[model samples]
Target: MLKRLVSAWVWISTGLIALIWLPWMGLVWLFTARDPGRYSVGRWFRLAAVTVTRLNPFWKFRTTGVQIHDPRRPYVAVANHESLADIFLLSHLPWEMKWMSKDTIFRIPVMGWMMRMAGDVMVIRGDAGSRMRALEEARDRLRKRVSVMIMPEGTRSGGGELLKFHDGAFRLAIETGSPVLPIALAGTRHAIAKGSWLVGRARAIARVLPPVETAGMTLDDVPALREKVRTMIAEARTVLQRELAAAGA
Candidate 1:
């Protein structure tokens, strides 16, 4: 009962903020033509979402590990998707990365407008052409020295187990000669289930691992590269689970 009430209040505040931010974003976009990645505009948008997760007393979120500091280095950032809450945790990362969101998300009202103004890429599933277009956009961002983020699993693994990783992110890394950055997420599976209104108490942690260089990798090396990242994330997730357990989470 308490959790539900907190969720209700949080959603109200979050929605209100999103509604207000839409116009603000539009005004800003008009001036800067949407600032580049990791700029003030994008960071403000990320923090807006972080407000929702932080205001919830029932959830504890933390992000560990360091990102590459080279301003000219871009990577294909991939993470294991566990829940929508995972997004909030990701926004907590120090630098900004372009989110490869689904088309349906970009079709929403105020929320969608904010995402667009913030320069996120929209991907339409099952449409090969749309996917290709989205990939091109992501590639463009990477070339601009801005990282692109994708979930290799494509969807949340509700059972709290790793899913079969896809090859798109790997292919993107190799094709662009960008490194692959793996982020392992733990304790987010039940934070906010897809079809539920009640928020679950969770201790979520996002661990960003070192980048796997793909300087000379080719298409034939994608399979091996994919497994290598998945394995690294899996091991990190295991260690995070232990840490959460040790903390009584």
Candidate 2:
């Protein structure tokens, strides 16, 4: 009981601070921009998130299987969506990656501004025109050697079970000939869950599976490629669940 109370307080406070700080930092980055060679500003934004995570007592992030991300090439990375922490956790990845998030997130004060500055793609769910625009922007980013991270599951899952992924991400990979990086996140469900503020500590693991090359693969190969990605991520999901069970809930 005491642990839950402390966790809630810590999470609320951290959110309030981030609400103010993220936008301020965004404006600062805009007026005093220095590094222009970067296509994705994820590295810089991640540094800020790391500081907050270290100070906040609500929960912590753990990672494994990082050696899979190659620093040399851009990748189209996809992962399972379990909780809001998925965003911050993915930022911890070593590669320079961009997120494809909801269009409304860009309307937020600091968070949205920073996302724009970072070149992250935003989508208005269920709107055909908006989806098309987001797809074009994503393709352009890929062509310029910027890796985009997307949650093909589209939204957070209530049960942590694997959800169906859309064909958009796979289609983009086939069109651009970029390798697809399949990632699986485990244990985040316990950190901050769906429709709940209650928090708890869990041993979260991020597994970056080997990249599935799309170099010679054509549009006709998307179906097979999607199935392969689903299998790889599911393997990691099983490992994560087993680890959680071994930890005794």
Candidate 3:
């Protein structure tokens, strides 16, 4: 009962923070219209969520090995999606990247407004036209030297595990000749379970692994590239789960 009450407060706190932070971001949008990357403004938006993570006593999140010397050097950043909390975990990353999320997320009132203001890309699942358009938009972000973040799994797993990979992210990387940046996320599955509103206690970590350059890769290489990155993320996720478990113990 106590945990649930704290979780309730955490969610409420997140909502309140969003309400308070968004107005300032709206004002920022006016001046940053030409800067679609909106990197600085987006940073402020994510910091609001970071504030929630700090308020929640039952959740702990951190990042490791993310040293982007040139923040403008674009790469296709991919991660294994464990839960909704994965977004919060990645928010801990230092540099700003335009997130590729579902269109449903872009329809939310204030939250969706932030997504648009941040120049994030959104797609409808199973809609061919939407997928193509979203891909083109993501390519544009990369061309502008803004990294794009995507979850190849497309949906959250029940635990800190991966699903069958999709070709979109890898294909984009190869098409644009951008390197593939894999980030391994663990323990977030405990933060928020599938199809539930209640938050759970968790210690999550997002580990940025080395980048795999796709200088000469083509569409035929997407399959191999996709599995290679998936394997890399899976292995790192295994290590992170152990570290999180040991710390909790």
* Best candidate according to TM-score: 3
lDDT of the candidates, in the order given: 0.85, 0.77, 0.89
Q: Which candidate leads the pack in lDDT?
A: 3
- Score every model by TM-score: 0.94, 0.87, 0.96
Q: Candidate 1 lDDT, tens digit per residue, 153-248?
A: 988765778999999999999999999999999988768886677788899899999999999889999999999999999999999999999998
Q: Which residue pairs come into collision in candidate 2?
A: 23-110
Better of 1 and 2 by TM-score: 1
**Preferred candidate (lDDT higher): 1 or 3:** 3
| 236: Cα error in model 3, Å | 0.5
Q: How many residue pairs collide in each prediction? A: 0, 1, 0
Judged by lDDT against the true structure, how good is candidate 3?
Answer: 0.89
Q: Which run of 10 residues does model 3 get worst, by summed lDDT?
A: 153-162
